[model samples]
Target: MDTLFDLDEAPATDPFDPSVSRPYDLLRHDDGADYAATVTGGGSAVVCGDAERVLAAMPAGCVRAVVTSPPYWGHRDYADPAQIGHEETVFDYIERLADLFEGVRRVLADDGSLWLNIGDSYTSGGRRTRMADRNNAARTIDFRPDTPEGMKPKDLIGVPWMLAFALRERGWYLRTEVVWNKPNGQPESVRDRPTRSHEYLFLLTKSEKYFYDVDAITGPNGRRNRSIWDINTVPLAESHDAAFPPELVYTCLSHSSERGDLVLDPFLGSGTTAMVAGSMARRFFGIELNPEYVSIITRRLAGRAAA
Candidate 1:
């Protein structure tokens, strides 16, 4: 297999420098050679690049499992045109995500599973701007897509279900929908409706019978795990705004993979997946679009290794 890991120099040994971290400046691969080589030659890696292009270049069946949360549509402007969320229409955004996950499906092992954490959004009601919330500053954006066709203002667009069914149509099995109940959910100022307190985590697989360790996630009660996961949302203090809590990643990985399995995260926001995978002794391959987040992952992984 022509693996895409390309290293130009010896891997950085200092945990602070993080040999596993690879810098992919947007679509450019010039600086990622060393990191790529480390991934191909060693166990784990974090790369900076467009998820679609990076997934396309990787060999088939390369990862044992995938756990990710891509940017939500109409959520935040990631300061990149190539970013997934912010499409002209809701359908456009869903189609783009489906297309990107097609590459993800190809690279995933046949017995592998995908744990996707996606949040829902409401139609902007033709509003062009979103004011920054005192609780979540990242909510501020200059542009929001006009109300999607056939949907009125304030209608909840079923982005998570839409993408889930879309991937099912593309041959992935729709396995389960895990409700990620957030105890510390951000407060919404809406008056009429109840405050939103949960997002959907869809479990998908390439085949009907895939690798899942039910015992790994068995609760203290010694009963079967339920679909509702009560994991709190953990936000990054700097660099990245929204990040997956370590407990969330830990739950998904424990159920889907064994120790030392290669885990893939196409949308490695805040590097939660990689960090948790490392702690569990699982190998991780992460691709992030923003270079700033890549730096954050570098320091985080280095910090973990040093500790």
Candidate 2:
């Protein structure tokens, strides 16, 4: 099988530059600065910061797989006024996300795979958001929607398709789109259309061929049982604005990566990736711009160590 590990082409770009500042690298082992403590056994590290900057710190072909969910366009506040996704036009969000993926492709092991989870956006107040116009928003939102429903973008479905197309344009292989069925998802009592429960998880490979160890990250019950996995209904110890379940992370990791491979989350909200990585014996590196979140994740990881 053709693998992502084989890179005979000349380097297209140089990420190492003195001008670019290296993001914070808090290396944590099972027995060190609880905050800097790395996960025991062989796993991956979750580095924190802009994906580009974080990728710069890592050696090329160091990561076996990347499983992450970046901030959706106009979805939530990243607490950074200048960040790309927050408060930006959909077009800008897609472009910026694509830029990050470009960097991800660079550092990713030739045989590595990227599992990205992203959802669409809808404009409030009944407006139709066009995919083409949304693209321009990232550039500039000068054009206004036609009707009130059109004024704001809603039911943002094709954004991922646009992203896939963009990545394909850059030579990244477009793989299958896996649906994350939220069996117990919060109900939405909408007057029109069905409630949105599931989201799309795009499994994109760096090259046409990549490494995938399906059995490594299998759950306690294993993959033979069923495709639908249960969502953790337990309340978090602390309040995290946006957090995904460890089960989801675990499933992705177990299937896509192996022991000792690096796992990165550029948008490390509340450090779920770090926590799961530690438990599963995988190294983790997470980046959060907000100092408060950084502290929350640090304390959470520390608490895990104490437990």
lDDT winner: 1
**TM-scores, in order shown?**
0.87, 0.72
Which pairs of residues have clashing backbones in candidate 1?
Answer: 5-36, 6-33, 6-36, 6-37, 7-33, 7-34
Which model scores highest in TM-score? 1
For model 2, the superposed segments whose C-alpha errors exceed 4 Å read: 1-48, 125-155, 216-235
Candidate 1 structure quality by residue, lDDT tens digits, 56-142 = 767788688999999999898889879988899979988999999999998889999999999999998888999888776778888
Q: RMSD of model 2, in Å?
A: 11.4
Q: What is the lDDT of residue 265 in candidate 2?
A: 74
TM-score of 2: 0.72
Query: Could you tally the backbone clashes for each prediction?
Result: 6, 40
